[model samples]
Target: MRPGQRGARGRRAAVTERNPGREVSAAKALQKVRGQIRLHLLSHRTSVTASGTLHLKEGDVPYTATSRHQGTASVAIKHIPQELVKRKLLMINGDVHDVPVEVVLILKATGGPESAGSSAAMYLLDWYDLDQELILVLERPVPCVDLRQYLKEKGGSLQEHEAKIMMQQLVEAAIELHSKQVFHRDIKLENIIVETGPDVPRARVADFSCGCFARKGHYHLFSGTPKCAPPEWYMHARYKARPTTVWQLGVVLYGMLDGHPSFDTLRFLRNKLPINSELSQNCQELLQMCLSKVPKQRPTLEQLQHHPWLQ
Candidate 1:
Protein backbone atom coordinates (compact mmCIF):
# COMPACT_ATOMS: atom_id res chain seq x y z
CA MET A 1 0.00 0.00 0.00
CA ARG A 2 2.87 2.36 0.72
CA PRO A 3 5.05 1.41 -2.24
CA GLY A 4 3.69 3.95 -4.73
CA GLN A 5 3.19 7.73 -4.83
CA ARG A 6 -0.13 7.58 -6.65
CA GLY A 7 -2.49 9.66 -4.50
CA ALA A 8 -5.98 8.78 -3.31
CA ARG A 9 -7.61 11.25 -5.73
CA GLY A 10 -5.88 9.83 -8.78
CA ARG A 11 -6.78 6.35 -7.72
CA ARG A 12 -10.40 7.35 -7.30
CA ALA A 13 -10.57 8.77 -10.81
CA ALA A 14 -9.08 5.63 -12.28
CA VAL A 15 -11.50 3.51 -10.33
CA THR A 16 -14.43 5.63 -11.40
CA GLU A 17 -13.61 5.07 -15.06
CA ARG A 18 -13.92 1.29 -14.76
CA ASN A 19 -15.76 1.04 -11.43
CA PRO A 20 -18.25 -1.70 -12.57
CA GLY A 21 -20.93 0.04 -10.52
CA ARG A 22 -21.83 2.15 -13.51
CA GLU A 23 -24.95 0.86 -15.24
CA VAL A 24 -25.66 0.37 -18.96
CA SER A 25 -29.09 -0.61 -20.23
CA ALA A 26 -29.48 -4.23 -21.28
CA ALA A 27 -32.02 -3.38 -23.97
CA LYS A 28 -29.80 -0.67 -25.42
CA ALA A 29 -26.83 -2.99 -25.25
CA LEU A 30 -28.75 -5.67 -27.11
CA GLN A 31 -29.78 -3.12 -29.72
CA LYS A 32 -26.15 -2.10 -30.29
CA VAL A 33 -24.92 -5.55 -31.30
CA ARG A 34 -28.14 -7.34 -32.25
CA GLY A 35 -27.56 -8.23 -35.88
CA GLN A 36 -23.80 -8.06 -35.72
CA ILE A 37 -23.35 -10.61 -32.95
CA ARG A 38 -24.51 -14.21 -32.61
CA LEU A 39 -24.12 -16.58 -29.70
CA HIS A 40 -23.98 -20.41 -29.98
CA LEU A 41 -24.39 -22.07 -26.60
CA LEU A 42 -23.24 -25.67 -26.15
CA SER A 43 -25.45 -28.06 -24.22
CA HIS A 44 -24.98 -31.25 -22.17
CA ARG A 45 -21.39 -30.30 -21.35
CA THR A 46 -20.30 -31.04 -17.83
CA SER A 47 -19.18 -27.47 -17.17
CA VAL A 48 -21.88 -25.43 -15.42
CA THR A 49 -21.53 -22.56 -17.87
CA ALA A 50 -20.56 -22.43 -21.50
CA SER A 51 -18.41 -19.31 -21.07
CA GLY A 52 -15.39 -20.41 -23.07
CA THR A 53 -17.41 -22.81 -25.21
CA LEU A 54 -18.83 -20.57 -27.93
CA HIS A 55 -18.88 -20.08 -31.69
CA LEU A 56 -19.70 -16.46 -32.46
CA LYS A 57 -20.60 -14.83 -35.77
CA GLU A 58 -20.43 -11.08 -35.83
CA GLY A 59 -21.05 -9.95 -39.39
CA ASP A 60 -18.38 -12.25 -40.82
CA VAL A 61 -15.94 -11.16 -38.09
CA PRO A 62 -15.61 -14.22 -35.90
CA TYR A 63 -13.91 -15.26 -32.66
CA THR A 64 -14.32 -17.74 -29.84
CA ALA A 65 -15.35 -16.75 -26.31
CA THR A 66 -12.91 -17.11 -23.43
CA SER A 67 -14.94 -15.81 -20.50
CA ARG A 68 -15.51 -16.49 -16.80
CA HIS A 69 -19.04 -16.80 -15.43
CA GLN A 70 -20.36 -16.45 -11.91
CA GLY A 71 -23.63 -16.04 -9.97
CA THR A 72 -25.04 -12.81 -11.28
CA ALA A 73 -26.50 -12.23 -14.73
CA SER A 74 -25.80 -8.51 -14.36
CA VAL A 75 -22.09 -8.87 -13.66
CA ALA A 76 -21.76 -11.24 -16.58
CA ILE A 77 -23.34 -8.79 -19.00
CA LYS A 78 -21.57 -5.68 -17.71
CA HIS A 79 -18.15 -6.20 -19.29
CA ILE A 80 -19.36 -6.78 -22.85
CA PRO A 81 -20.30 -3.29 -24.02
CA GLN A 82 -17.24 -1.67 -22.50
CA GLU A 83 -15.02 -4.03 -24.47
CA LEU A 84 -16.87 -3.47 -27.75
CA VAL A 85 -16.80 0.31 -27.33
CA LYS A 86 -13.16 0.20 -26.33
CA ARG A 87 -12.12 -1.67 -29.47
CA LYS A 88 -14.29 0.59 -31.62
CA LEU A 89 -12.67 3.72 -30.23
CA LEU A 90 -9.20 2.28 -30.71
CA MET A 91 -10.04 1.59 -34.35
CA ILE A 92 -11.63 4.99 -34.89
CA ASN A 93 -8.74 6.89 -33.37
CA GLY A 94 -6.27 4.73 -35.26
CA ASP A 95 -4.48 3.90 -32.07
CA VAL A 96 -4.19 0.19 -32.85
CA HIS A 97 -5.81 -1.21 -35.92
CA ASP A 98 -5.74 -4.86 -34.98
CA VAL A 99 -6.82 -4.94 -31.36
CA PRO A 100 -9.14 -7.91 -30.72
CA VAL A 101 -12.48 -7.71 -28.96
CA GLU A 102 -12.79 -9.71 -25.71
CA VAL A 103 -15.93 -11.89 -25.58
CA VAL A 104 -17.32 -13.79 -22.60
CA LEU A 105 -20.32 -15.98 -21.77
CA ILE A 106 -21.80 -16.31 -18.30
CA LEU A 107 -23.44 -19.63 -17.54
CA LYS A 108 -25.17 -19.43 -14.19
CA ALA A 109 -27.48 -21.82 -12.42
CA THR A 110 -31.17 -20.88 -12.45
CA GLY A 111 -31.54 -19.55 -8.92
CA GLY A 112 -29.54 -16.48 -7.79
CA PRO A 113 -30.13 -12.77 -7.29
CA GLU A 114 -28.87 -10.68 -10.21
CA SER A 115 -26.90 -8.25 -8.06
CA ALA A 116 -25.34 -10.44 -5.38
CA GLY A 117 -21.97 -11.13 -6.99
CA SER A 118 -18.88 -9.10 -7.99
CA SER A 119 -18.91 -5.67 -9.61
CA ALA A 120 -19.73 -5.41 -13.32
CA ALA A 121 -19.86 -2.54 -15.82
CA MET A 122 -23.26 -2.01 -17.46
CA TYR A 123 -23.53 -3.73 -20.82
CA LEU A 124 -26.00 -6.54 -21.33
CA LEU A 125 -26.80 -7.79 -24.81
CA ASP A 126 -29.12 -10.72 -24.13
CA TRP A 127 -29.15 -13.65 -21.72
CA TYR A 128 -31.42 -16.69 -21.52
CA ASP A 129 -32.12 -19.12 -18.71
CA LEU A 130 -33.65 -22.48 -19.60
CA ASP A 131 -33.76 -25.89 -17.94
CA GLN A 132 -31.79 -24.61 -14.91
CA GLU A 133 -29.05 -23.16 -17.13
CA LEU A 134 -28.44 -19.47 -17.83
CA ILE A 135 -26.49 -18.57 -20.95
CA LEU A 136 -24.98 -15.07 -21.24
CA VAL A 137 -22.94 -13.65 -24.10
CA LEU A 138 -19.91 -11.37 -24.57
CA GLU A 139 -16.88 -10.83 -26.91
CA ARG A 140 -13.17 -11.85 -26.83
CA PRO A 141 -9.96 -11.19 -28.70
CA VAL A 142 -9.42 -13.01 -31.95
CA PRO A 143 -6.32 -14.78 -33.42
CA CYS A 144 -5.31 -15.16 -29.80
CA VAL A 145 -4.96 -17.90 -27.22
CA ASP A 146 -4.67 -18.33 -23.48
CA LEU A 147 -1.18 -17.71 -22.03
CA ARG A 148 -0.95 -21.29 -20.77
CA GLN A 149 -1.45 -22.72 -24.25
CA TYR A 150 0.78 -20.08 -25.78
CA LEU A 151 3.63 -21.04 -23.46
CA LYS A 152 3.24 -24.72 -24.25
CA GLU A 153 3.32 -23.95 -27.99
CA LYS A 154 6.47 -21.89 -27.59
CA GLY A 155 8.13 -24.88 -25.97
CA GLY A 156 7.58 -23.63 -22.41
CA SER A 157 9.30 -20.24 -22.41
CA LEU A 158 8.56 -16.99 -24.19
CA GLN A 159 11.18 -14.65 -25.63
CA GLU A 160 12.05 -11.74 -23.30
CA HIS A 161 10.53 -9.03 -25.50
CA GLU A 162 7.25 -10.91 -25.80
CA ALA A 163 7.12 -11.50 -22.07
CA LYS A 164 7.73 -7.81 -21.44
CA ILE A 165 4.84 -6.75 -23.64
CA MET A 166 2.43 -9.18 -21.98
CA MET A 167 3.52 -8.22 -18.46
CA GLN A 168 3.23 -4.51 -19.10
CA GLN A 169 -0.38 -4.77 -20.16
CA LEU A 170 -1.08 -7.23 -17.38
CA VAL A 171 0.38 -4.90 -14.77
CA GLU A 172 -1.65 -2.05 -16.17
CA ALA A 173 -4.78 -4.17 -16.00
CA ALA A 174 -3.99 -5.11 -12.41
CA ILE A 175 -3.64 -1.48 -11.48
CA GLU A 176 -7.01 -0.82 -13.02
CA LEU A 177 -8.52 -3.68 -11.02
CA HIS A 178 -7.03 -2.54 -7.70
CA SER A 179 -8.08 1.01 -8.38
CA LYS A 180 -11.63 -0.24 -8.84
CA GLN A 181 -11.50 -1.96 -5.45
CA VAL A 182 -11.54 -5.37 -7.14
CA PHE A 183 -9.18 -8.17 -6.18
CA HIS A 184 -8.69 -10.69 -8.92
CA ARG A 185 -7.72 -13.55 -6.62
CA ASP A 186 -7.04 -15.71 -9.65
CA ILE A 187 -4.22 -14.33 -11.79
CA LYS A 188 -2.61 -17.12 -13.71
CA LEU A 189 -1.60 -18.05 -17.25
CA GLU A 190 -4.98 -19.64 -18.02
CA ASN A 191 -6.87 -16.51 -16.98
CA ILE A 192 -4.76 -14.22 -19.17
CA ILE A 193 -5.45 -14.14 -22.92
CA VAL A 194 -2.71 -13.03 -25.30
CA GLU A 195 -3.73 -11.14 -28.44
CA THR A 196 -1.74 -12.78 -31.21
CA GLY A 197 -0.38 -11.67 -34.63
CA PRO A 198 1.06 -8.38 -33.47
CA ASP A 199 4.81 -7.75 -33.43
CA VAL A 200 4.31 -7.89 -29.66
CA PRO A 201 1.17 -9.58 -28.43
CA ARG A 202 -1.05 -7.64 -26.00
CA ALA A 203 -2.57 -9.30 -22.97
CA ARG A 204 -5.91 -8.95 -21.18
CA VAL A 205 -6.78 -10.19 -17.72
CA ALA A 206 -10.00 -12.22 -18.09
CA ASP A 207 -12.31 -14.09 -15.70
CA PHE A 208 -13.84 -12.55 -12.62
CA SER A 209 -15.76 -15.36 -10.94
CA CYS A 210 -12.91 -15.93 -8.53
CA GLY A 211 -12.72 -12.16 -7.81
CA CYS A 212 -14.50 -9.98 -5.29
CA PHE A 213 -14.63 -6.40 -4.06
CA ALA A 214 -11.68 -5.60 -1.79
CA ARG A 215 -12.99 -4.55 1.60
CA LYS A 216 -10.42 -2.61 3.63
CA GLY A 217 -6.94 -4.23 3.59
CA HIS A 218 -7.84 -7.71 4.74
CA TYR A 219 -9.60 -10.59 2.95
CA HIS A 220 -10.46 -13.34 5.39
CA LEU A 221 -10.66 -16.17 2.87
CA PHE A 222 -8.51 -17.22 -0.06
CA SER A 223 -10.28 -18.00 -3.35
CA GLY A 224 -7.76 -18.60 -6.13
CA THR A 225 -5.43 -21.13 -7.67
CA PRO A 226 -3.19 -22.67 -5.02
CA LYS A 227 -0.11 -22.41 -7.21
CA CYS A 228 -0.12 -18.60 -6.98
CA ALA A 229 -0.72 -18.44 -3.21
CA PRO A 230 1.61 -16.23 -1.18
CA PRO A 231 3.76 -17.41 1.71
CA GLU A 232 1.78 -15.37 4.21
CA TRP A 233 -1.37 -17.30 3.35
CA TYR A 234 0.30 -20.54 4.33
CA MET A 235 1.71 -18.96 7.51
CA HIS A 236 -1.29 -16.97 8.75
CA ALA A 237 -4.17 -18.71 6.91
CA ARG A 238 -5.39 -15.36 5.53
CA TYR A 239 -3.84 -12.87 3.08
CA LYS A 240 -4.02 -9.15 2.50
CA ALA A 241 -5.02 -7.74 -0.88
CA ARG A 242 -2.11 -5.76 -2.30
CA PRO A 243 0.74 -8.05 -1.27
CA THR A 244 -1.02 -11.16 -2.53
CA THR A 245 -1.53 -9.42 -5.87
CA VAL A 246 2.16 -8.56 -6.13
CA TRP A 247 3.12 -12.15 -5.39
CA GLN A 248 0.79 -13.49 -8.07
CA LEU A 249 2.23 -11.15 -10.67
CA GLY A 250 5.66 -12.39 -9.79
CA VAL A 251 4.52 -15.97 -10.29
CA VAL A 252 3.07 -15.01 -13.67
CA LEU A 253 6.25 -13.28 -14.86
CA TYR A 254 8.42 -16.14 -13.72
CA GLY A 255 6.21 -18.67 -15.48
CA MET A 256 6.32 -16.67 -18.71
CA LEU A 257 10.09 -16.36 -18.84
CA ASP A 258 11.10 -19.70 -17.38
CA GLY A 259 8.35 -21.78 -19.01
CA HIS A 260 7.19 -22.87 -15.53
CA PRO A 261 6.73 -21.53 -12.01
CA SER A 262 9.71 -21.62 -9.68
CA PHE A 263 7.65 -22.55 -6.62
CA ASP A 264 4.15 -23.70 -5.84
CA THR A 265 4.22 -23.86 -2.04
CA LEU A 266 5.15 -21.43 0.71
CA ARG A 267 8.13 -23.55 1.55
CA PHE A 268 9.22 -23.45 -2.07
CA LEU A 269 8.50 -19.70 -2.54
CA ARG A 270 10.51 -18.97 0.61
CA ASN A 271 13.24 -20.89 -1.16
CA LYS A 272 12.27 -20.16 -4.77
CA LEU A 273 14.27 -22.28 -7.15
CA PRO A 274 16.98 -20.25 -8.85
CA ILE A 275 15.56 -17.82 -11.37
CA ASN A 276 16.41 -18.34 -14.99
CA SER A 277 19.87 -16.91 -15.63
CA GLU A 278 18.91 -15.92 -19.15
CA LEU A 279 16.79 -13.04 -17.83
CA SER A 280 18.41 -9.58 -17.74
CA GLN A 281 19.52 -8.32 -14.33
CA ASN A 282 16.74 -5.73 -14.12
CA CYS A 283 14.12 -8.29 -15.01
CA GLN A 284 15.56 -10.59 -12.40
CA GLU A 285 15.55 -7.80 -9.83
CA LEU A 286 11.89 -7.04 -10.49
CA LEU A 287 11.02 -10.69 -10.02
CA GLN A 288 12.94 -10.77 -6.77
CA MET A 289 11.01 -7.78 -5.43
CA CYS A 290 7.72 -9.37 -6.46
CA LEU A 291 8.38 -12.89 -5.19
CA SER A 292 9.69 -11.69 -1.83
CA LYS A 293 8.78 -14.08 0.97
CA VAL A 294 7.64 -11.27 3.23
CA PRO A 295 4.37 -9.68 2.15
CA LYS A 296 5.43 -6.19 3.22
CA GLN A 297 8.55 -6.41 1.10
CA ARG A 298 6.50 -6.83 -2.08
CA PRO A 299 5.92 -3.82 -4.36
CA THR A 300 2.56 -2.08 -4.60
CA LEU A 301 0.61 -2.26 -7.87
CA GLU A 302 1.58 1.30 -8.83
CA GLN A 303 5.23 0.69 -8.05
CA LEU A 304 5.26 -2.60 -9.94
CA GLN A 305 3.95 -0.94 -13.10
CA HIS A 306 6.88 1.47 -13.19
CA HIS A 307 9.49 -1.06 -12.24
CA PRO A 308 12.64 -0.68 -14.34
CA TRP A 309 12.08 -3.96 -16.14
CA LEU A 310 8.62 -2.98 -17.30
CA GLN A 311 9.80 0.43 -18.49
Candidate 2:
Protein backbone atom coordinates (compact mmCIF):
# COMPACT_ATOMS: atom_id res chain seq x y z
CA MET A 1 0.00 0.00 0.00
CA ARG A 2 1.12 3.55 -0.60
CA PRO A 3 2.35 5.43 2.40
CA GLY A 4 -0.47 6.95 4.54
CA GLN A 5 -3.21 5.15 2.56
CA ARG A 6 -3.84 2.73 5.38
CA GLY A 7 -3.94 5.53 7.91
CA ALA A 8 -6.27 7.51 5.72
CA ARG A 9 -8.63 4.60 5.39
CA GLY A 10 -8.50 3.94 9.12
CA ARG A 11 -9.25 7.57 9.83
CA ARG A 12 -12.22 7.43 7.50
CA ALA A 13 -13.53 4.35 9.31
CA ALA A 14 -13.09 6.07 12.68
CA VAL A 15 -14.89 9.17 11.41
CA THR A 16 -17.87 7.02 10.57
CA GLU A 17 -17.80 5.43 14.06
CA ARG A 18 -16.96 8.41 16.33
CA ASN A 19 -18.65 11.63 17.33
CA PRO A 20 -17.89 14.26 14.70
CA GLY A 21 -18.58 17.20 17.03
CA ARG A 22 -16.13 15.93 19.64
CA GLU A 23 -13.39 15.49 17.04
CA VAL A 24 -13.89 19.02 15.80
CA SER A 25 -13.81 20.36 19.33
CA ALA A 26 -10.59 18.45 20.07
CA ALA A 27 -8.92 19.85 17.00
CA LYS A 28 -9.98 23.35 17.96
CA ALA A 29 -8.53 22.86 21.41
CA LEU A 30 -5.21 21.77 19.95
CA GLN A 31 -5.11 24.83 17.74
CA LYS A 32 -5.95 27.03 20.67
CA VAL A 33 -3.02 25.64 22.65
CA ARG A 34 -0.67 26.18 19.75
CA GLY A 35 -1.85 29.74 19.42
CA GLN A 36 -1.30 30.33 23.11
CA ILE A 37 2.23 29.03 22.85
CA ARG A 38 2.96 31.40 20.02
CA LEU A 39 1.51 34.33 21.90
CA HIS A 40 3.54 33.50 24.98
CA LEU A 41 6.73 33.29 23.00
CA LEU A 42 6.05 36.52 21.18
CA SER A 43 5.29 38.35 24.38
CA HIS A 44 8.70 37.54 25.80
CA ARG A 45 10.56 40.04 23.66
CA THR A 46 13.42 40.94 25.99
CA SER A 47 13.35 38.27 28.68
CA VAL A 48 16.22 36.27 27.16
CA THR A 49 18.47 39.17 26.25
CA ALA A 50 17.63 41.09 29.43
CA SER A 51 18.82 38.23 31.60
CA GLY A 52 22.39 39.59 31.28
CA THR A 53 23.73 36.22 30.12
CA LEU A 54 23.37 36.66 26.36
CA HIS A 55 24.95 39.75 24.81
CA LEU A 56 24.51 40.75 21.19
CA LYS A 57 27.96 41.94 20.29
CA GLU A 58 28.80 44.77 17.94
CA GLY A 59 30.17 44.29 14.43
CA ASP A 60 28.30 41.04 13.83
CA VAL A 61 29.09 39.35 10.54
CA PRO A 62 27.01 36.92 8.54
CA TYR A 63 28.00 33.53 9.87
CA THR A 64 26.26 31.33 7.32
CA ALA A 65 24.80 33.08 4.31
CA THR A 66 23.06 30.88 1.77
CA SER A 67 20.38 31.87 -0.69
CA ARG A 68 17.82 30.28 1.61
CA HIS A 69 18.90 31.59 5.04
CA GLN A 70 21.49 33.63 6.95
CA GLY A 71 22.81 33.87 10.52
CA THR A 72 24.89 36.42 12.49
CA ALA A 73 27.49 35.87 15.18
CA SER A 74 27.71 37.40 18.68
CA VAL A 75 30.02 37.43 21.71
CA ALA A 76 30.32 34.57 24.21
CA ILE A 77 28.22 34.54 27.39
CA LYS A 78 28.57 32.56 30.59
CA HIS A 79 24.97 31.84 31.54
CA ILE A 80 22.30 29.70 29.83
CA PRO A 81 19.08 27.99 30.80
CA GLN A 82 19.66 25.68 33.70
CA GLU A 83 17.89 22.84 31.89
CA LEU A 84 20.34 22.95 28.97
CA VAL A 85 23.28 23.23 31.33
CA LYS A 86 22.02 20.26 33.36
CA ARG A 87 21.52 18.15 30.27
CA LYS A 88 25.08 19.00 29.18
CA LEU A 89 23.76 19.69 25.69
CA LEU A 90 26.57 22.07 24.74
CA MET A 91 29.94 20.57 23.80
CA ILE A 92 33.35 22.23 23.43
CA ASN A 93 36.05 20.22 21.72
CA GLY A 94 33.98 17.03 22.17
CA ASP A 95 33.74 17.50 25.93
CA VAL A 96 30.67 18.32 28.01
CA HIS A 97 31.83 21.15 30.21
CA ASP A 98 30.76 24.59 31.33
CA VAL A 99 32.09 26.66 28.49
CA PRO A 100 31.51 30.20 27.34
CA VAL A 101 28.49 30.70 25.09
CA GLU A 102 29.20 31.51 21.46
CA VAL A 103 25.95 32.39 19.72
CA VAL A 104 24.60 32.82 16.20
CA LEU A 105 21.46 34.79 15.51
CA ILE A 106 19.11 33.25 12.96
CA LEU A 107 15.74 34.77 12.18
CA LYS A 108 13.29 32.25 13.52
CA ALA A 109 10.70 31.23 10.94
CA THR A 110 9.12 28.19 12.58
CA GLY A 111 7.20 27.56 15.80
CA GLY A 112 7.86 24.66 18.11
CA PRO A 113 9.17 23.88 21.60
CA GLU A 114 12.91 24.36 22.02
CA SER A 115 15.04 21.68 20.41
CA ALA A 116 16.09 18.77 22.60
CA GLY A 117 19.71 18.28 23.62
CA SER A 118 21.81 16.55 20.98
CA SER A 119 25.50 17.15 20.36
CA ALA A 120 25.02 16.30 16.70
CA ALA A 121 22.52 19.16 16.42
CA MET A 122 22.99 22.83 17.20
CA TYR A 123 21.56 23.85 20.57
CA LEU A 124 18.85 26.50 20.80
CA LEU A 125 20.29 28.49 23.64
CA ASP A 126 17.77 31.32 23.69
CA TRP A 127 15.30 33.33 21.60
CA TYR A 128 13.74 36.78 21.51
CA ASP A 129 10.60 38.21 19.96
CA LEU A 130 11.46 41.64 18.60
CA ASP A 131 8.69 43.72 17.03
CA GLN A 132 7.08 40.63 15.48
CA GLU A 133 10.40 39.24 14.31
CA LEU A 134 11.52 36.13 16.15
CA ILE A 135 15.25 35.68 16.51
CA LEU A 136 16.81 32.44 17.64
CA VAL A 137 19.98 32.39 19.72
CA LEU A 138 21.80 29.27 18.57
CA GLU A 139 25.10 27.87 19.76
CA ARG A 140 27.97 28.86 17.52
CA PRO A 141 30.78 26.34 17.19
CA VAL A 142 33.94 28.35 16.63
CA PRO A 143 35.97 27.76 13.43
CA CYS A 144 33.21 26.00 11.48
CA VAL A 145 31.40 26.46 8.20
CA ASP A 146 28.27 25.11 6.63
CA LEU A 147 28.69 21.78 4.89
CA ARG A 148 27.78 23.26 1.53
CA GLN A 149 30.64 25.76 1.77
CA TYR A 150 32.91 23.10 3.20
CA LEU A 151 32.18 20.81 0.24
CA LYS A 152 32.86 23.67 -2.16
CA GLU A 153 36.21 24.39 -0.51
CA LYS A 154 37.07 20.68 -0.67
CA GLY A 155 36.63 20.54 -4.46
CA GLY A 156 32.88 19.84 -4.49
CA SER A 157 32.90 16.41 -2.82
CA LEU A 158 34.32 14.51 0.11
CA GLN A 159 36.24 11.27 -0.02
CA GLU A 160 34.37 8.10 0.89
CA HIS A 161 36.08 7.76 4.26
CA GLU A 162 35.52 11.37 5.24
CA ALA A 163 31.94 11.23 4.04
CA LYS A 164 31.40 8.13 6.13
CA ILE A 165 32.51 9.88 9.28
CA MET A 166 30.20 12.83 8.75
CA MET A 167 27.33 10.69 7.50
CA GLN A 168 27.47 8.49 10.59
CA GLN A 169 27.23 11.53 12.84
CA LEU A 170 24.34 12.91 10.76
CA VAL A 171 22.46 9.64 10.92
CA GLU A 172 22.82 9.54 14.67
CA ALA A 173 21.64 13.14 14.87
CA ALA A 174 18.55 12.31 12.81
CA ILE A 175 17.80 9.40 15.10
CA GLU A 176 18.11 11.62 18.14
CA LEU A 177 15.80 14.23 16.67
CA HIS A 178 13.13 11.66 15.91
CA SER A 179 13.48 10.09 19.33
CA LYS A 180 12.82 13.49 20.85
CA GLN A 181 9.73 13.86 18.61
CA VAL A 182 11.32 16.65 16.53
CA PHE A 183 11.09 16.17 12.78
CA HIS A 184 13.72 18.22 10.96
CA ARG A 185 11.88 18.28 7.66
CA ASP A 186 14.88 19.69 5.82
CA ILE A 187 18.23 17.88 6.14
CA LYS A 188 20.71 19.10 3.53
CA LEU A 189 24.22 20.42 3.14
CA GLU A 190 23.35 24.05 3.79
CA ASN A 191 21.59 23.23 7.03
CA ILE A 192 24.55 21.30 8.40
CA ILE A 193 27.62 22.93 9.97
CA VAL A 194 30.98 21.16 9.89
CA GLU A 195 33.21 21.89 12.87
CA THR A 196 36.72 21.99 11.44
CA GLY A 197 38.41 22.41 14.81
CA PRO A 198 38.00 18.72 15.50
CA ASP A 199 40.47 16.17 14.11
CA VAL A 200 37.60 14.58 12.18
CA PRO A 201 34.98 17.08 11.08
CA ARG A 202 31.84 16.93 13.24
CA ALA A 203 28.48 17.57 11.60
CA ARG A 204 25.89 19.58 13.49
CA VAL A 205 22.39 19.73 12.06
CA ALA A 206 20.98 23.28 11.95
CA ASP A 207 18.09 25.28 10.53
CA PHE A 208 14.71 23.90 11.57
CA SER A 209 12.49 26.37 9.78
CA CYS A 210 10.73 23.53 7.95
CA GLY A 211 10.55 21.30 11.02
CA CYS A 212 7.61 20.26 13.17
CA PHE A 213 6.77 17.89 15.96
CA ALA A 214 7.06 14.31 14.77
CA ARG A 215 3.70 12.62 14.84
CA LYS A 216 1.96 9.56 13.51
CA GLY A 217 0.01 10.06 10.27
CA HIS A 218 0.66 11.62 6.89
CA TYR A 219 1.79 15.22 6.50
CA HIS A 220 -0.12 16.67 3.61
CA LEU A 221 1.86 19.89 3.55
CA PHE A 222 5.39 19.85 2.14
CA SER A 223 7.68 22.67 3.31
CA GLY A 224 11.14 21.33 2.51
CA THR A 225 13.21 21.96 -0.63
CA PRO A 226 11.44 20.80 -3.78
CA LYS A 227 14.51 19.17 -5.28
CA CYS A 228 15.15 17.15 -2.15
CA ALA A 229 11.57 15.96 -1.53
CA PRO A 230 10.85 12.23 -1.78
CA PRO A 231 9.16 10.63 -4.82
CA GLU A 232 6.28 9.46 -2.66
CA TRP A 233 5.30 13.07 -2.04
CA TYR A 234 5.13 13.83 -5.75
CA MET A 235 3.10 10.72 -6.54
CA HIS A 236 0.68 10.62 -3.63
CA ALA A 237 0.70 14.21 -2.29
CA ARG A 238 1.29 12.80 1.19
CA TYR A 239 4.29 11.35 3.02
CA LYS A 240 5.23 9.80 6.36
CA ALA A 241 7.99 11.41 8.40
CA ARG A 242 10.46 8.56 8.75
CA PRO A 243 10.47 7.58 5.07
CA THR A 244 10.89 11.18 4.00
CA THR A 245 13.83 11.58 6.38
CA VAL A 246 15.54 8.48 5.00
CA TRP A 247 15.09 9.75 1.46
CA GLN A 248 16.73 13.07 2.38
CA LEU A 249 19.68 11.23 3.90
CA GLY A 250 20.11 9.52 0.55
CA VAL A 251 20.05 12.88 -1.18
CA VAL A 252 22.78 14.18 1.11
CA LEU A 253 24.92 11.08 0.51
CA TYR A 254 24.43 11.34 -3.24
CA GLY A 255 25.58 14.95 -3.27
CA MET A 256 28.60 14.10 -1.16
CA LEU A 257 29.72 11.36 -3.53
CA ASP A 258 28.67 12.83 -6.90
CA GLY A 259 30.04 16.33 -6.22
CA HIS A 260 26.96 17.81 -7.87
CA PRO A 261 23.65 19.32 -6.99
CA SER A 262 21.12 16.94 -5.50
CA PHE A 263 19.27 14.95 -8.12
CA ASP A 264 15.97 16.34 -9.22
CA THR A 265 13.20 14.11 -7.92
CA LEU A 266 11.39 14.01 -11.25
CA ARG A 267 14.54 13.17 -13.17
CA PHE A 268 15.43 10.50 -10.67
CA LEU A 269 11.93 9.05 -10.88
CA ARG A 270 12.21 9.03 -14.66
CA ASN A 271 15.45 6.99 -14.22
CA LYS A 272 17.54 9.67 -15.97
CA LEU A 273 19.60 10.17 -12.83
CA PRO A 274 21.84 7.31 -11.78
CA ILE A 275 24.03 6.69 -8.74
CA ASN A 276 27.70 7.12 -9.59
CA SER A 277 29.13 3.73 -10.48
CA GLU A 278 32.59 4.64 -9.27
CA LEU A 279 31.48 4.57 -5.63
CA SER A 280 32.42 1.46 -3.68
CA GLN A 281 29.97 -1.46 -3.65
CA ASN A 282 28.92 -0.89 -0.05
CA CYS A 283 28.43 2.81 -0.59
CA GLN A 284 26.40 2.19 -3.74
CA GLU A 285 24.19 -0.33 -1.95
CA LEU A 286 23.51 2.06 0.89
CA LEU A 287 22.60 4.81 -1.53
CA GLN A 288 20.39 2.53 -3.55
CA MET A 289 18.53 1.35 -0.46
CA CYS A 290 18.05 4.90 0.80
CA LEU A 291 16.90 6.27 -2.57
CA SER A 292 14.51 3.38 -3.17
CA LYS A 293 11.36 4.44 -4.98
CA VAL A 294 9.42 2.34 -2.54
CA PRO A 295 9.55 4.03 0.83
CA LYS A 296 9.34 0.70 2.63
CA GLN A 297 12.49 -0.46 0.94
CA ARG A 298 14.59 2.17 2.68
CA PRO A 299 16.48 1.22 5.77
CA THR A 300 15.43 2.61 9.13
CA LEU A 301 17.71 5.14 10.83
CA GLU A 302 18.92 2.42 13.19
CA GLN A 303 19.69 0.16 10.24
CA LEU A 304 21.57 2.96 8.52
CA GLN A 305 23.67 3.41 11.64
CA HIS A 306 24.76 -0.19 11.41
CA HIS A 307 25.25 -0.20 7.63
CA PRO A 308 28.57 -1.69 6.52
CA TRP A 309 29.78 1.52 4.89
CA LEU A 310 29.26 3.51 8.04
CA GLN A 311 30.66 0.74 10.26
Highest lDDT against the true fold, candidate: 2
Residues forming the 10-long window of minimal summed lDDT in candidate 2 = 1-10
Q: Show where candidate 2 strays beyond 4 Å.
A: 1-118
Query: Which is the leading candidate under TM-score?
Result: 2
Q: What is the RMSD, in Å, between candidate 1 and the native fold over all Cα?
A: 17.5
Residue 177 displacement (Å), model 1: 1.2
Give a tens-digit lDDT track for model 1, residues 74-186. Answer: 12232232122211112122222221122222221111224222212212334432222223343344466878998998899888888888888878777766664556676
Clash list (residue pairs), candidate 2: none
User: TM-scores of all models?
Assistant: 0.60, 0.65
Give the whole-model CA lDDT for all candidates, comma-separated.
0.55, 0.63
Model 2 C-alpha lDDT per residue in residues 166-190, reported as the tens digit of each score: 8998898888767655677778888
